[model samples]
Target: MKKFAVGIVSAAFILGAGTAVFAAGTNNSDNGFSFEKMLPFMQKMHPDQPSRN
Candidate 1:
């Protein structure tokens, strides 16, 4: 019984950790960048896109 409880707890922890890692990369702006900083890189990489400014 003790081993079973420990196995359940370990599985929960592993699943929770896996979810947290997956969530970290889902948001593109996770690092927090502003338009001013992002615009130049975007413009250089994608010259075809019309700049809103």
Candidate 2:
């Protein structure tokens, strides 16, 4: 029982740490990748093809 409890706590701590790191990484807006910047180029390359879905 004690081992199980320790395992659960450790798993939770690791998950929480990973989530915090991910959140911190995503907080930076200037990661150099932007879809809005590339939109015009994409539009020029693929002009309004009807979706074949």
Candidate 3:
């Protein structure tokens, strides 16, 4: 029972740390990779198609 409890606590802590790291890594400081900015380029590339869908 004690070992099981310790394992659960460790798993929870690791999961939380992983989630935080993933969230931190996703932030784009340059603002270069945005849908709003890419919309024009995408439209120009596929003029025939209204939307990529």
Candidate 4:
């Protein structure tokens, strides 16, 4: 039971971490800094869409 709980906790942590990682590039503005570095990669991922840059 203890091991099962640990596994669930770890899985939740990992999935939550991925959400945080993907959210990092959402604030695409120059107020202080931008996620421009991720833009090209995101564009490549969806090449059919027009680049927003």
lDDT by residue (tens digit), candidate 1, 26-49: 566646775666888989999998
Candidate 1 residue spans exceeding 4 A from truth: 29-53
TM-score of each: 0.51, 0.56, 0.54, 0.48
lDDT of 2: 0.79
For candidate 3, the clash count comes to: 0
Give the lDDT of residue 2 in candidate 3: 100
Comparing 1 with 4 on TM-score, the higher-scoring candidate is 1
Which runs in model 4 stand beyond 4 Å of their true positions?
29-53
Worst 10 residues of 1 by lDDT: 26-35
Q: On residues 1-53, what C-alpha lDDT tens digit does candidate 3 reach at each position?
A: 99999999999999999999977876775754766677899899988986746
Worst 10 residues of 4 by lDDT: 26-35
Candidate 1, position 52, lDDT: 75
TM-score computed on alpha carbons, candidate 1: 0.51
In model 1, residue pairs whose N, Cα or C atoms come closer than 3 Å (at least 3 residues apart or on different chains), thus clashing, are none
